[model samples]
Target: MKFSKTLINWYSINKRDLPWRKTTNPYYIWLSEIILQQTQVKQGLPYYDAFTAKYPTVFDLANANESAVLKLWQGLGYYSRARNLHATAKHIAFDLGGKFPNTYKDLLKLKGVGDYTASAIASICFNEVTAVVDGNVYRVLSRYFGISTAINSTPGAKEFKQLAQKLIDTKQPAEFNQAIMEFGATQCKPKNPDCDTCPFNSSCIALSKNTISELPVKIKAAKAKKKHFNFLVFISEDEKTIIEQRQGKGIWQNLYQFPLIETEKATNFKSFKSLIKDHELLTNQDFELLLYNKEAVVHKLSHQHLYTHFWIIKVDKLPINGINIENVRDFPVPILIGDFIERFNF
Candidate 1:
């Protein structure tokens, strides 16, 4: 009771004035949560504003085209979240008649709503006494209790979740959940936490034991896999260019990009040009291939690092399905390709 009260008290004075915190609407809360996942508040705020303004309601989001949603979500990364969000919005609007689930269990049924998101929406919107265990919650709890269990481990997850549930304030689950998470984010941060001013500094186990830096342990992730991508940028005399929509499940699925030829490893210009010469898109076409970038553009994702090269192919005529070069900006592409387009100057 004291722990919960202390956190809520601190929260009242220290919590950020975020837009989502001001609303109890499940749609708004759910949208904020999805955008904030694996994203910093500073980086995610603009996207949240854009999404809410554009959609305004669940029905609007459901009615929006996937391309538009992806376009709005561009540069935010984690594109699958955008796709799942679109799918879930449609399901809610059409199938459920625009009513978001009120309980954690029911919310879990949504395509992108996992345990953390479900719990957040359930508690914040519906006043359900469900505890939300996200990265911030894990950090706050582990450091306060001096728990050394690896947070990524299954047992660690179960233990921390159980502890958080037991510590939640039944009378004010929303405030308690937000308080603890806020405390972790602003005070008990991952690096150089402000221990002297923290509400729990006197009694926090990690603070007393000088283990604040080591309390919330996480297992190291595997090395990012390296991939080589050679994008063929076709430019025709008639101001047309070729862009292909990525299909199947993988990075940047459903996004548009130039014709690509991936290699097992980075290749020299001569070897890469030879590979492009045999490409089906260039079959029997008289073209001049020029390497746009001598150095590979390294784009890093969570699990993969992409070494990309843009090959500019000047052609007399483009394929029948090619689009005008000026309109390429309208298509949603990965930030890697998007950056290239912005810098390539047509």
Candidate 2:
């Protein structure tokens, strides 16, 4: 199709010279794809450098400790991705003898490697003629062809993939795939797109009919439920803060954070004090709420919005039960708590 030629021509001159795009190294390609998920280019660039610099090979990453890996991925949300990356690296290094999977099916067998990621690595690194249909390709294809099916729907995703496959240049799959992705990201943005400069503007169904913004129909995501948390930053007599490693199945599982007390609703001052008074953890200690940290940050996840109230409490001595205080900083904590510590010198 002419779409492939047009896109490759444009990409040869306009595509961003990203570091990951400079080589066909499977490990670097895999790292780029994982980091780019749910993250913008500007945000993921530094992380890409840090990860590649620290662990130059699959073996290096495979042998790294989980805590060390999570610490590197602290600020980046979606801790599961980091864990999966570590696991996948270990599998490749130990099980496969440090050689990364060379095909799409092999890549898909690894943890956290979904269809999109598999296609990306297969085509970009190995020149496999697999279509890479990401958010950009979805938007560009749906709008250009005026497909109104919800992008997240099963049939909708399949239809888009077929259309993308038709446009992929079999001879130069890597350049052609990247070209379309770049075109969608730069010109056919979700907001006011630069249709005047877009090469497909004349033929684009959305641009011709003046419906650019609404062409890529998508199912609206469910509303996030509110969760109120009262985090007590208990500073011990020896200046250690109480921390615990989260275990079992739940949000933030396998991560570390300060001791938490969740409530059905937001607690007022009186109720908060009363709840602390009745709680067994603080009932026997000489704990006193010293100052209320005014800067309460709302951390939003895909399905939950956590409204955290940080209370700086002073305890004459640390609690001996239900909490671990020794070498708390050795374990990796959540980024929210890290930000709190940075702000208040905790």
Candidate 3:
């Protein structure tokens, strides 16, 4: 009771005035939760605003084209979230009569709605007593109780969830959940927290034990894999180029990119020309190839590092499937390609 009350009190006084906090609408709440996943508040605010302004309702989102959604979601990375968000909106709007599930269990049935997201929607929108154990909650709980378990471990996740559920205020579950998460994000930050003024500083086990930096430990992830990508940028005399959609499962699915010719290792100009000579698009065509960047551009993702080289192919006429160069910006592309488009003059 004391712990919950202290957190609630701290939250009431110190919580940031975020737009999502002002609404209990399930559509808005769910949107905010999905956008905030793997994204910081500062970075996601504009996107949230853009989404709300553009879509306005679940039906609007459902009716939108996937390309538009992906385009709006450009530079936000982890594109699967946008795709799932769109699919779920269609399911809710068309299949569920535009109704959002009111319970955490049912909310989980929605695409992309995980335990933390479902709990957030259920508590904030429906006032259910479900606790959310996001990164912030884990940090706060581990430090306060001096738990040394690795947060990413299965046992640690279960133990922390149980502790959080046990501490939730039944009568004020919404406030308690929000308060704890807010407390963790603002007060018990990951680095150099101002423990001297914290409400729980005296009772915090990690503070007393001086293990604040190490309390909420996480297992290190495996090293990222390396990949080499060679993008063939086709430029014709008529200012036309070709961009193909990434089909099937993998990174950047459904996004557009220049026609690709991947290789095991970096290729020298002599070897690259031989490879291009064999390409069906370049065969029997009078053309010249120029390497766009002398040095490979390294694009890093969560689990893979792509060493990319763009090879510019200049020809008198492009294939019939080519698009006007001016319209390239209309297509949704990965940030790597997007950055290149912005930097390279057509």
Candidate 4:
């Protein structure tokens, strides 16, 4: 039997009954695909259900506020996905006149709808013959075909995409796509793959040679830049605190955070006092620092490590320029900052 047929046969009997698999609605399919991009299936399912339940259709998502969308996606991280999802929904609702794109080519034109995502939505929802080549599929094909190209490089992506397209079973496009991905997810996993039980184990190159762990070659990742941030949490007598929402492009875009001072070196009390005084931060008198906490939390991003310090300050009045008195729970904040608030409670 051919690889595609064998894989589909295996999938029919062994695939997990996921919530996304039950529906052919492109909106929900797109939601699942986007949520599952950087997240594991187990972690992503609840988020998928939450989003779909809250915003049932593209119109619902498109009509929602950016803050509300970000708030719902608070803990999920990789916020660009949420932002793009919203943008795409709006495009569909307004420009496309509330009609979700049904074809792979049309879906690809939407914001953040890359080849893999477009293909997944197209095949699963419309039965289009589009190939989806994600990390799992990359691993499966690299090992099966004994391809040595670095998976992240341009040449590697092109080669794998071509293989995926050629190997796709046109008659059962949806099943073919799902099976290859599911096979990679369950049996041909990144680490400790269960080759003995896999239907393709008999002919799988990596299994035959003990190269399963090494087949999916990846180039070394660049080192993450380390940056330090000292957050000043100014609390009024009424317990309201000063906060500001980050604006413009870059990390933590449009997320609410407390007043912060970033420094290359760890900030000391004397330097902080001098710096604030230089900036004329306080109006009349020097604000007294009640207590200084030594604990520094390290939040890791894909390309950076954020070393954050929380300084609690009690002030007679809030800063007139940079601070806003708002409920922290009501605003959209990054998950790391949210965790910081929960841990400190101020």
**Best by TM-score, which number?**
1
User: How well does model 2 score by local distance difference test?
Assistant: 0.84
Q: Over the full model, what C-alpha lDDT does candidate 1 score relative to the true structure?
A: 0.92
Q: TM-scores, in order shown?
A: 0.98, 0.94, 0.98, 0.95
Q: What digit string (tens of lDDT, one per residue) describes model 1 on residues 12-79? A: 99989999988899999999999999888999999999999999999999999999999999999989
C-alpha RMSD in Å of predicted model 2 compared with the true structure? 2.1
Off by over 4 Å in 4: 290-292, 321-326
Across 1-346, the per-residue lDDT of candidate 4 in tens digits comes to: 8999999999999899999999998889999999999789998988998999999989999999988998888888888888888988898888989878899888889888899999999999999998999989999999988888999999999999999999999999999999999998998899889887888888888777878889899999999999988887777666677678897888888778877889997777777767666444456555666434675688899999988887777667755643334467788888877887776765
For residues 130-239, could you state the per-residue lDDT of candidate 3 as single tens digits? 99999999999999999989999999989999999999999999999989988887889999988989999889999999999996999999999889899999999989
Task: List CA RMSD, all candidates.
Answer: 1.0, 2.1, 1.1, 1.7
Per-residue lDDT of 268 in model 4? 76
Candidate 4, position 13, lDDT: 94
TM-score of 1: 0.98
- Each model's lDDT: 0.92, 0.84, 0.93, 0.85
Better of 1 and 3 by TM-score: 1
Q: How many backbone clashes does candidate 2 have?
A: 0
lDDT of 2 by residue, 1-346 (tens): 3878878988888889899988899999999999998788889999999999999998999999988998888788888899999999999998999888989998899899998899999999888989999999999998988889889999999999999999899999888888888888887888888888888867889877777878799899999999988888887667767777888877776788777899998777777877787665565766778546544579888899998888777777765542444455567778777777667765
User: Cα miss at 36, model 3 (Å)?
Assistant: 0.5
